[model samples]
Target: MTATATAAVIAPAPEAAPALRDTRPLRLITCGSVDDGKSTLIGRLLWDTKAVKEDQAAALNRDSGKQNDLGLPDFALLLDGLQAEREQGITIDVAYRYFATDKRSFIVADTPGHEQYTRNMATGASTADLAVLLVDARAGILEQTRRHATIATLMGIKQFVLAINKIDLINYDKARFDELSLEFKEIALSLGVKQVTAIPVSALKGENVVYDGKASMPWYEGPTLVEVLELATVRSAQTVGFRLPVQRVSRPGESFRGYQGTVAGGAVKPGDSVVILPSGMVANVKQIVTFDLVRNAAVAGDAITLVLDRQVDVARGDMIATIDAQPQVGLAFDAQLVALQPGGIEPGKRYWLKSGSRRQRVSVQPSSLLDLKSGKWNRHDGALPMNAIGKVHLSFDEAAIFDAYELNRTTGAFILIDPDTNNTVAGGMISAKRGDLGGLNNEAERVILSLPADLADKILASGILSERRDEIDIRRTNPGRAAELLGELDS
Candidate 1:
């Protein structure tokens, strides 16, 4: 019999609260290797929480065609809403679901587990507070599991739940659960994730998910999945100072000039001093406007129109930030990126880098590639293949604004768009400013390139030197200065 059929034979006990509940909606992503029961887990969470409406349940029943012995409709049917997913019995894209309990609410992202859809998983994870990484109890850990964990860490997720699912398949074996938990704890530590909860669950049976499974596994004494989610801490962006990347300048009227954008970090209020970046124009906040009542102040995640006290040359792509705490501004930076497209990220190739509301031209140079299996950085300076993570140096044509992703995720994250195809080729996080690599260096170590005037003009006009022209020094050779320089060199 299937796990769902077995669940019908078992009786559920009364539910009880484990601890004081947090009211904030916990945003989380469910991800793992393919066929790891991500869809079923989410469907069951929704079903047990009574989030599914009667009409929706009835539709699921009709679409599923057959019911398990427990009279439960195929739970996966509720989340695999796409026609292709329904036909293939797999989730292709990220499916978001909303459910609530007495203590808290949730916005769960049911992400595809397939390796090719890893980019979709990353997209979902970008906004999640916690990650539930599922694994079949019989299959220990796979490479895809490590990939998901690595990506989750790179995306700034600190809380993790290692769902050793299908525990029933192993006869509710406690030893196997302990072994997997120990192994995963090591992996979590390696990724700098200190908060990890491991649970043996039969998502197909609703065991240790919403309700306790003491009837079948009395030896286990951990909180259910719902309990852990209720108590998990939400990520906060208050530590980073205020940031507002201007999306557009509102000119509803000539007198009403307002800059509009979402607050990326910290808080802003009227009379606060702020600076416009790349241009470094300073202004004081006049008002915070919104569709509703004019807000006294705006915090991170608030979308508001900010009016400055003085007229300035502020435009889209410029950042309005606290003067004392500003984002890093430089021509070069270090970053880690996950190549998303099949074409991969080619070194020394120019791509469009978009962060916040600003997009600029940048050339990427690969520094090292991450080995998912060993969780080590291998020395590499080549094309970063799709799904590969690599450390790279980004050289920009203009001043690039960012923060270290470790400090503020909102200001630190960016995407690389291919100029030729206009497709997003990679997602990256700023590590640090490439400080002073171009600073005063030993002149004796510099290489000089000499060519005829026509050849040099051709090289400069070919766009190859367009990005590096500012770093190059050119001098016109003459009989007077040339001889004088040669004489000094001989001395």
Candidate 2:
């Protein structure tokens, strides 16, 4: 039986005590189009749960510090801290807020609802176990709804709650709810989204947000919003593998030194033999240490220090793994990407590639492009335009271990950094190597042109535009020029 089918079977229990017992926290990121109430939903969830402190609530209510034309406390204002977001009445960036009910603690990333902020939404969802997708009940599903949902699935958020918000405007009608649910279910399933639970909500009014499901809509039979979150299988989704991406080597003063980062996946126990990926160095975990305390083992969420048997040459951007499940290392990779910025990404462009803790220089060579809307792959496009997701063959300057993005998001996913500003420019899920392509191996191609001077010239000459000419002109330029230029250095 399917897990969703099993969940249906276990709906009825013998006791009235809370159905969910696990305290394993889930990270949720809210996504939708602008004015879809993404922030309001977050504020409402916090408000109804009494998670927001009394002082903060009081501060919001004060006459001197209030906002919005409605004057009824711009509930979204609680999250839209940026001056631009509040003034424009739109979310422009990703905002993180934490709250907890007795059943589950949540690290909620309230992402921007603007179409331009899809990259931010993907960034937030890249780490999320569940996505709370909001759709305005009055508007039904818009283009942004489908876009966010599709992006959510692409980022590997396995679970979803399709929140049909603004139900108050729809007269709390079951027929309208059913129609909207049916329409969204079709879209969700088409995108390979699983286990969707359509819920009617009024994030602005606090209906069926945390409690009082009895009074809002008796026709709805599912668990309340909080109940669903508390019972959802978040931990099982996260505990899939062992991935420790070294973010930094911690040597505070002379008293102690250790590795610092949130454990990405699986569990690590002291004395567990682990391997440093791309380096292949083996070491037994001497101890798992954290601020003010030490433990025998460390699981996900434990931001503790790990002491290895011997000091291997470890640093930021390296991955430590259990020897048996070490990640695959390659200099060349394929990725499906959506460009957000104005410039086009092309071959020989040196963007910072950050996977887990490891960041290295990567040169992109476009092999194909996928029209994300049609879900069709387009090979030979040679360039990815704004908001276009296409398969790209990329060559990295260094070999780093990569877990398939589907297996472990934290380790498998990566972001492209702007070499000039260091801002994350693109998000990617590491699929398979280009070996699958007929007689084309990016790794082999990179190796053949691995000369340092050749690589340098390529990096200097890649991107949408160059010092010399337009994007089209740059693509037309010969990369062989770099190899030919290397002869000058040799001479």
- The prediction achieving the highest lDDT against the true structure is 1
Candidate 1 residue pairs in backbone clash: none
- Poorest stretch of ten by lDDT in candidate 2: 468-477
Q: Pick the candidate with the highest TM-score.
A: 1
lDDT of 1 by residue, 1-491 (tens): 68887777563422235243466788999999999999999999999999999999889888877656666789998889889998889989999999999888899999999999889999999999999999999988999999999999999999999999999999999999999999989988988899999999999899999999999999999999999998888899876789999999999988999999999999999988787887766778999999887889999999999999999998899899886577777788889999999999999999999998999999999989989888889999999999999999999999988988978888899999999999999999998887555342233222233333454465567676576666653323224544554445346
* Per-residue alpha-carbon lDDT of candidate 2 for residues 1-491, written as tens digits (9 for 90 to 100): 69999877776654534655456668889998778898998988888777778788887677225454445666787788888886887888889888887666888999987777777887788778888888888887887777788788888776889888888787888898899889888877787776888888888877777864557688988766777787677634354556678888988787566777788888899877677766766677888887778787887667877888787888877777765455667767767666776565666678888776677888877777655455555675465666656567677666757777777777777878889877666778877655424334443322222223345556446541244332111111134655564556456
Query: CA lDDT of each candidate?
Result: 0.87, 0.73
> Which ranges of candidate 2 are over 4 A from the true structure?
1-21, 63-72, 212-218, 235-241, 247-262, 286-294, 303-316, 367-380, 436-491
Deviation of model 2 at 448, angstroms: 24
TM-score of each: 0.84, 0.75
Candidate 1 regions exceeding 4 Å error are 1-21, 67-71, 438-491
